[model samples]
Every structure is written in structure tokens, then in C-alpha cells.
Target: MNLYLLRHTQPDVAPGICYGQTDLGLAASFDAELQRIRAGLAEVHVDHVHSSPLQRCQRLAAALAAGKVHQDPRLMELDFGEWELQLWETIPRGLVEVWTEDYVQHAPPGGESFFDLQQRAISFFDEVSANNEDLLVVTHAGVIRALLAHALNMQLLDAFRLRVDYGSLSQLELQDGRVTVSAVNRRF
Candidate 1:
């Protein structure tokens, strides 16, 4: 099975703000971003295409999938609940410190833990792998990180060390219950 994990195009949100699972719009570069995405997919075809329900990802998936797409909530970014839209620096510094110390287990005031996100991603992967066919998923960066962590067998905290930029595609190969990363952050 091959997985093509694509992060959504740049979101229309303020920089330095925490907008996890907020359902934001794409930046003004939609045309250019779509072009790049098309260029990357010019040589690859997948059995199916899936996308997070959030508009940021859905918009891109809709364009790429040509009206046939599967929308899944499990592919959403980490839920930051109360932290959504709040500037990172404005969050209580002490709380940030505590969360940083054990981010894998720590959930924001009303959010979820990285472990939780990873579990959902693994579940989604499980479902997608059942067909043993190529799949393209347009989702958020957090979801990409979670999927990458599972594919690479890295700790949730260690997953943070990997940087997944917007409009990037990472490929993974799954066989005999093991995963191998074929590429990371491949952008056009």
C-alpha cells in the first residue's frame, strides 16, 4: 500500500496564532498552489482520494479530486479547543511550560493530547490500508505529523521535530505491517 499525504495549502490566518481544527480559508495563492499540486500529481495516480472535512483541506481536495472525494473527520488537525485563534505568546506562559514538558500527554485547556491525535491517525491509516491501494489524503499539518509518526514509528514528541510545510506531500509505503518513508515534504 502506498500513501500520499498532502498538507493543505497555506491557510488564511494570522501568523503565530494557534488555529488547530479551526476551518480556515486558503491564502490568496490558491491558483498558484493548485498549479503546484497539479504538477506534483501529474505523474501519479491513486486508487482513491480522501480529505479532511475542514474547508482548508476540502477546498484543495475538491479541486484535485475533480468532484469525487472522500471527506473524513478523522483526518482533521489536532483539536486545540480553547486555544484556537489565541496567539501562542498570549497563552499563559506557565501552562505552555507544562504542556511543553510533556506535550504528548498534555492537552490544552479544552483540547486533546498528541497521543490522541496519533491514535486517530493510526485508525484512519488502518482503514485506508484495508484496500492495499494507493491513496491520497489532503489534510492538515498536524494530521500529517501524526501519520508520519506512525509510519516512522517515532514518539509523539519526536514527531514534533519533523517539519511539514503547507502544500507538501510525503509518501509512505506499507507492506507486511511495516512502513517505510519514501519521501518527505516533496513540493512542486
Candidate 2:
């Protein structure tokens, strides 16, 4: 199985706002970025393409998916709920303390926890691994982090350490139930 995890192009969001699953559009200059990503992936011969339902990812997936574009809710970004659209720096100190102390345990009001995301990601991986074919996944930074955590056998909390840049590519290959991380955070 060859998995190509592609992070979406830049989003149209204010610098401090937390915009998970907000359905924001791409940045104005995304065309050039998309062209670069498409060109970088020209030789992959993708057999399947998957994406989160969010427009930011779906738009990019539609353009890159020469084979099939499948939307999976399990691939969506972690919902920030009350924190959505709020500047991180401006969040109340008490909330920040709670978040910092136990992000995996603390579910944002009406949202999801990091551990919840890990479970969803694990389920998605199980489905994908069964197919064992080349796949292109267009998704959010959080999805990429979850995928990396699964591939590298890292703790869910450790997922925060991985940096998934916009328009970057990460590759994971699986053979006979064994996994190998071929590359990560490769810019086009």
C-alpha cells in the first residue's frame, strides 16, 4: 500500500483564528500552489483519492483525483467548537490551562478530543490498509498528524510534534502488514 497524504492549499483565515472544519475556501493564490502540487504528483499514478468533506480539501481533491474522489467524514479536521473562529492567543487562561494539561481528555465544547480523532484515524487506516493500493488523501493538518502517529506508532499527544505544512506531501508504504514511512513534509 502506497499512501500519499497531501495537505490542502492555504486557507482563507485570519492568522490567529482556529478554523477547523469551518468550510473555508482556499487562498486567492491557490491556483499556483495547486499547479505545483499537481505537477509534483504527476508521476504517482494514484489509484484512489480520498478527502475530508470540508470545501478546502474537497476542492483540491476534485482537481487531483484522476481516479476516484471519496469523501470520508473520518478524515475531517478536529472540530474546535466554541474555540472555532476564536483567536488562540485570546482564549481564556483557564481554558488554555485545561487544554494544555489534557488536550486528549478535554473535548472542546460540543467538539472532539485528540483521542477521538485518533480513533477515527485508526478506523480510516484499517479500511485503507485492507485495500493495499496506491492512494492519494487530500485532508487537513490534523488528519496528517493522525496518519503520522499511526504510521510511526507515536502517542496521540505526540501528534502535535509533527508539522504538516500547506500543500505538502507525506508518504507511507505498507507491505505484508508492515509499515514504512517513506517521506514526510515534502514541499512541492
TM-scores, all candidates, are 0.96, 0.96
Off by over 4 Å in 2: none
lDDT, candidate 2, 69-111, per-residue tens? 9999999998998888989888787887888788887877778
Candidate 1 is scored at a TM of: 0.96
lDDT (Cα, tens digit) per residue for candidate 1, span 68-104 = 8999999999898898999999999998899889878
Task: State how far residue 168 of model 2 sits from its true place (Å).
Answer: 0.4
Best by lDDT: 1
The lowest-lDDT stretch of 10 consecutive residues in candidate 2 is 100-109
In candidate 1, which residue ranges exceed 4 Å CA deviation?
none
* Root mean square deviation (Cα) for candidate 1: 1.0
